[model samples]
Target: MDNSQRIVTIKDIAQELKLSVSTVSRALRDSAEIKLETKMLVKEVAARLHYTPNPIALSLKEKRSKIIGVIVPEIANNFSSNTIAGIEDIAYKKGYHVLIFQSHEKYEREKENVQLLVSRRIDGLIISLANETQCYDHLTDTIDKNIPLVMFDRVCHSINAHKVITNDYFGAYNGVEHLIQQGYHNIALITLPLNLSITQNRLNGYKDAMKKYNLPVRDEWIIHSPIDVVCSEMTIRRILESDNRPDAIFISAERLNIICIKVIKEMGLRIPEDIAIAGFSDNPITPYLAPALTSVKQPTFNVGQKAAELIIELIENNNTTTQYRTIQLDTALDIQASSRRRQ
Candidate 1:
């Protein structure tokens, strides 16, 4: 390519201002050594020329890709999407790029994405575990390599890494307590695979709430539903069809909650009359529904922001992640018509 067609660089800006490349670089970075007037002039000229730093050159010089990798079970979900939006907002301000990958809730796929990100020399990683992930060896390998990593939403507790999560135990406790107060005695808990920490946390919450009110905790009521439409529908139907059908259903997360809502409508069940529904979701769609859903609202944006900040901290400041921090944020119970039992 001819000089005219080449991308403008710091050297171009320096030549345009009749200054050395180092002077232009320091001035652009606003170094104290460079005069304020010189820095101002350099920035004005750089902006006019639309000069952009070459990422490849920057990576080589700084020993960092200036890119952060994000892996989640599914990007299509509103919760995951909001978290990613928060992550990007912070990354952009900090002069870093984001690379996203969806694991599709497959353990193998998550492993492959992690490996690919490492191969690309990502400066850090922020992730949520896939539903089928049983072994955290791939993630352990990442930390063994001293790569900064932060886990959020769906996470493996045994792993030593910075994690951002909602208070699942209390969130579920509040949802179930609300149901009990509404006079729903037979409340079923629909959950993702029991392997997930969230599922277990929510399950315990339901059990504890039932015990608190002197209610029977039926073993059959806790349905371990996967994040699949067909599978969840069939399994949920089986539980509902049973003679011991529940008066209420508290789903573990948004994905399963959506499926449960569809299944309930298909069976022509009335909200809070035939069955009351409550679960975890901060998605706006809940409020717009005919009988707005009762849900536990997690801090999606805050969790994302905190996770990104932690990863960036580990990346830039070389913070020792061995002393891992598990930041558990609060959740709010959004009461609505779905679980508003009649007197």
Candidate 2:
């Protein structure tokens, strides 16, 4: 509680109304023991004094729940699981409990998860928006209720909150530059759906690199696929089988990148010699792939750690405020045989 505004107790209301503490309590509780006029008067005064009866109403004031609620799209993904590890590192060290939930890329499920976490009276919330979530009114509702909310990967910019992400644009640029340095000029970008900031940043990076090198960025070389394996395989097969197939490929999503490798090998194309590749990867098995995949590695665990630190900052702060600042971490390109050509 702020020194300027102390919590209003039933005794204070009783003193103001010239009644006993028990009488004021009964009035505020709507107990049948109290007269209707007395109950109404007490309730009015309680609201006017900014009195809060529960943890949710109090926001981050007196009582701390010491628990953080985390929501993500998929827990099975290597990226998400590693990020959760980072979050747990900070949360447990600070003596806070972590509750995890999955939205499975569905908007309705995501909304339900938020409502459930809020009802549980979590101290703060960290979320990665679902692919299907276009409206942020539900998230804004959480903010309106004075909850501390932070968004990470696949976040919506319309919401005013702290965000943590890797520099996808530069990551993609560096990955493509690796391919260009290896003498692969016709590079195709098989990216995630373009509605997201991460995917769009990566696409722009690829385009800018091609423009800087004076290489043609053809419309046919760009493919948009959601998080579906079937969609990824279909798009990869179509482009790879084309008569004018790219000499190299840049994939934006981890799962999609893995899928592209599978499709390429099945098509009997020699990596680097036929079609080289590089993109974002968190999969540990990438090194063991046939050609040892060249990849732009995101700081998944570090992103989690940073997000935990920021959300805890929001939860523990006495003053209520929203700072729409983004903390961006750099991605490292793991050069390997897939994109590296040795003459």
Candidate 3:
């Protein structure tokens, strides 16, 4: 009020309202300690003056960064990018900042990243487990340290915590069963790190579907590769060139689908003509691909939003070291030209 026109603060509101700073603070925050009339008046005045609380000050007082650290397998992956965007959308609205880290699918890198986030004094964490992350000691340490953690997409089953994940088992099993229905008996599966729960679930789904259909499931039909373009493409090429070629291929991971497409193109094979294909992907471009790829679409954006909501709830309630909840969201099968039977 004494200087140039500027936004209002708690002190300014207190001065105008002729109340104590603490009372004004409580009123503006709608704390139950303040009288209802005072809260309404303070809220009305604060709205008029456009007074916004300084999160930095609150962060310092609370010994929190008001920041949520997000860990992903790779930033460049479509699913990871979209999921992060969803997380940020919610985090920003809740007056939180996100510090993103890429583990590059390495367990050591993931551990180091989590430690760094902890050292930075982040209020909470949201993570998509790395392919190589089998051990949950580092994750368990976060819970022990009283940091709210919400795992999304790829989660560790051993260390139970708030988890938001797609139903990988049903998704992969349905994809393979669809191929079987299309009369493709020789179905092959391409997957990433088998140690992770998502990988295991999808593999199990594939196996169960094969068993239910009485299809031959040879060990050689399951191809494991790094979650990357080069490795997946090479694996796909090897499978294509093998004497025991599969009439259909199922990719458990999204990134592997692109590599499979590239491999099929290189081999001059047509979709659903030379081989039927399906995979797990929520990539927007998936529908636009040549002979639009059939895939299992996870609710990536919803998963991110739900994870943020759960972490914030955990932080607010001071809930730690109790029974954790696992939330599994169902996936959708996108029937497209890639898996359509040649008529």
| Structural similarity to truth (TM-score) of each candidate | 0.84, 0.80, 0.81
List, residue by residue over 214-302, the lDDT tens digit for candidate 2: 99999989998767788779988999999998999998888787688888888998887888888799988888988899988989999
Q: What clash pairs does model 3 have?
A: none
- TM-score sort, best first: 1, 3, 2
Off by over 4 Å in 1: 1-57, 319-322
TM-score of model number 1:
0.84
Best-matching candidate per lDDT:
1
Angstrom error of the Cα, residue 40, model 2: value is 42
Better of 2 and 3 by TM-score: 3
Go through the candidates in order and give each one's C-alpha lDDT.
0.90, 0.87, 0.86
Task: Give lDDT tens digits, candidate 3, residues 206-252.
Answer: 99999998887888889888766786788789889998889999998
Query: Model 3: residues >4 Å from true position, as ranges?
Result: 1-58
Model 2 CA deviation exceeding 4 Å by range: 1-62
